[model samples]
Target chain A: MKKRITEPVKKPAVWIGFGVLFTLVTPWYFPAGSWSPLFWGIPYWALIIIAVSLALSIFITWVVLCQWDTGADETEDER
Target chain B: MNMELAFGGWSGILVLGLYGGLMLAVGLFAFLRHRGVRESLDEYYLGGRGLGAMVLFFTFFATQYSGNTVVGYPPTAYRLGYQYLVSVPFFIMIIMVYLFFAPRLYSLGRRFSLLTPVDWIDLRFRSKRVSVLAAILMLYGLGNYLLEQFVAIGQGVSGLTGGTIPYQVGVIFFIVIMVAYSWLGGMRSVAYTDTIQGLALLFGVFTLLIGSLIYLGGLPSAAATMAANAPQKLGAPTGTALTTWFCLLVLVGIGAAIYPHAFQRIFSARSERTLKRSFIRMAYMPFLTAGVVFMVGIIGISAFPDLTTAQSEQLVGMLANALANQNAFFYWAMVLLFGGVIAAIVSTADSVLLTFSSIISHDLYGRYVAPDASEYRKILVGKLVGVAAVVVLVLIAWYPPGTLYQIFVLKFEVLIQTAPALILGLYWRRLNTQAVFVGMLAGTILAAAFTFAGYRPLGVFSGLWGLSLNLLLCVGGSLLFGASPAQRERAEEIIAFPPSAAAARAV
Candidate 1:
């Protein structure tokens, strides 16, 4: 079987995905000083931001696991 | 953060003293196991480059989330409301930033046996001036960082012990304990204690959050308080708040990932897989640590309403005190929480001090001051200088110069300026050394001036401003005058990634 060696930095899809996730995390797109529709005490916009933050984490997990093998530790893996 | 509520002085003192003893024991244990820790720089500083996934994760944890996350961040959350929610994503952003450079850097570290971040700079540029400037910036930044930890340790100790242990005494006691253990086993000791400290901090914050929820109502009550009194806290950020939020994400994301100590940690990973695993753990930590603390702070709003900003800074202590009063179980837990706070501070200080000494031992003293010195002698010199630095910083903590305090506070702001040289050097082969040096120096000066003058153009942080100019000059200058052919070849040899299949087989 062949090794699937790659790096996150070499992947354009990873970059594009991160760019989108980072933009959503900042919560600027929401209306200013308008936080009605509070859910369990968290405002509506805040919930989206939380979900976005989680997405960033999950995206990071995917990048780390699936897209970041550089074959730098091939010997260790063999061991 | 200044908290007046003391959780029964004797328990605080007892727990802290026992905690210090346990740390000393851990150091002794590491020393016994790794007998060569003092004789070799790698064994001493990077734990033989054998840190497992868990130790590396906790050590990284200790670096980014210091005691301040517990003692300081909650107060900011209480004052600012959900706007401080940015803290969570910003920390996640740090891991995101790391994905850009860490993969290649880790490979390079393995190839070169890079001992410190400065060693990487030296290998990449081979310029004394550039490497030395980077070292001084890192040392100055780490020194300031250590000093801030010392200050926080004092405040945390005094707050926990209810003034029984004066701030001066508290600082001195922890410094002694920290220096003692660090001398015993070096990086092994720091990483081991960081595991313990990280666990304690996690337990403490979870308890605080649960206690706040049960004892002082939940976020809904806090949201109501904000809606009735200050709706802006609950509302999504806009205007200056929005800009501040964006600046925080960018500054903290890049700055923290390249913290000299944090950068050096990449060299300490046992393997690529270990490092990747540790980062995965870290990518989610902000939710557990910062997210929980933010909730505790929000709960503080309804529990103690209308506190002046000054008093709101005491939110954690006030909350801890209320919890302790409710039951015995809570009383002990709150005490442990304060102990965790102090432990977190010490863990951070230990790592900074270790990296500070490595720069002196491996980069400056070993390289320049005494070229023929043995590794043992170099290590000894680094330890003594580190101790000397601790004394100076502790004195500064005690007798803080009134107007000069801003210089000490420039730790992160100035340190962030080194990001371009450190990170860009990893990938961009044509990055000119002269451009790096000039950009770093210019950026630091601009950042210091803006920070001291309280000048933030368009609600952006001074550090981010400095970073922008730094990047501009670094990228623009490199474009105008790229590396020479020979320099290009060397950079290609160093950073061309994976080193080709044949080279790896030969190694």
Candidate 2:
């Protein structure tokens, strides 16, 4: 039984992306009393960071979906 | 508080009775359609792999976001104010965590005919000990999670009825409806009920928001009230609260993604495309569910003002009472909102019960105890376990118990213990199976120890603290005492670039 990952296991890229987005999302990075960059009344910081988080989520989903093999023969019967 | 009814009297009871009857009819219908043909475990548990994107999405949505978000979170927001805005993103982060395992797990689930997440653990580790332990953790966590929903059910029933129904009666009525559908219909029944509940929840939330704004004023006014009375509530995150926010994001994100019920949904997805689309849409739901609850709590700051912790849990009750006093429209909307909250909890409990039964029947009894058990016997065991689990959870709920958040976090901590095995198996070939076993065990121990001791590191969740140490052992121990060449070759074979025999067999 060969160990298999249907998609390339790209760890570093995913982790770094998560790290950056996480840093941006938290309020600690901002100085006290300063309004974050504005997106519909939210701080600019929150909107920007959530955008990054949003992007990361999409990328991870894409990466996961890519692993699907529509052509792979059924393994249940073979086993 | 034998308060007068604005729209209630029987409008509320009629609406609720209709909703409950409809849920049962759907479950009974699905059971009749699928019961005879469900000769295989896959047909029953995964709906024969035919669930469309919409059904799959709503089912997954119902499982992940529950009554807690609707009935519980506002109180936290009411108490803590803007500081709890973190709840919104934390919900989003759960989807992000799913990205880590969704692609690979879904593919493997389809390949191996996997029934539960523990089956995946069995495939990855090939260790009975690891698989059994994971199942136990799942069962324990799920039992606790189900109990929390029961508590919410009681609260929601009483709140909605204005105490027209007692708390115990409320819990029993809904639990009976839930068990009937779930026992008879499996995942299909659960998903259909979820669809109804999800729609009701969406309608109720928007209505509450509109009604609240019309009567209580908008967020800015509420913010002003917080700014005046409890300045810290409106202040920026700092000290322990900020650190806890980040910890919550990671803890909940990973913990939620790996939930047995959510993982089962990965198997239930009709296709990779369906799963992908569901999540893409899900990225915005925090805005609707969590975001609305956050708004509700924010309004509470001004509306009720200075509620004690126990009193704070009654935010929804307080708001509904106030709304009912206002006028007829507000009264009706409040009743619907309370009904939706109870429905949401029932839907979540059904999912948890389904997964719990699957773990017992498929993972433990079928795989280890009786590998050749017939599909009928397996389904029977699963259903029986589901009923038994509900019985125990109801008893636990009956006793005065822990805070909603505490029970919720405890579920995550237990589930996260399995991460090293599932996530690492995808990428780390040299993650020695014994090392994976030891790491997961140690991680769970540390998490439980810290949790029981009232030790929350830096005010972060105790589970992440355990996970930190767990990941270290898995990676560090693997490097220090490397696997034999044969084992390394086996590892490479198990985690290679393309689907292989070992990977296909994964749970």
Question: By lDDT, who's the top model here?
Answer: 1
Clashing pairs in 1: none
lDDT of 1 by residue, B209-229 (tens): 999899899999999999999
Q: Which tens-of-lDDT digit does each residue in B1-507 have in candidate 2?
A: 112233454666667788789999998999899866356778778877768888888898898788778777888888876678888788888887777667677776776667788988887777888888889889989888888888878766765665677779978988888888877777899898899899889888888777777787777677667656876666667788788778888888888888889888888877766777788778778878888888887887777777888888877777777777788877778788767877888899889888888888899889988889898898888888788778877787677456543544477888898888888787776777777778888998899888878888668777898898888888888888867677666665655545545556543
In candidate 2 the C-alpha lDDT for residue B81 amounts to 69
Clash tally for model 2? 14
After superposing candidate 2 on the true structure, give the runs of residues whose Cα lies further than 4 Å from its correct spot. A1-15, A33-79, B1-9, B400-409, B484-494, B500-507
Maximum-TM-score candidate = 1
- Measured on C-alpha atoms, candidate 2 has an lDDT of 0.76
Q: What is the DockQ of each candidate?
A: 0.86, 0.28
Q: Which residue window of length 10 is worst by lDDT in model 2 chain B?
A: B1-10
Worst 10 residues of 1 chain B by lDDT: B498-507
Provide the lDDT at B29 for model 2.
94
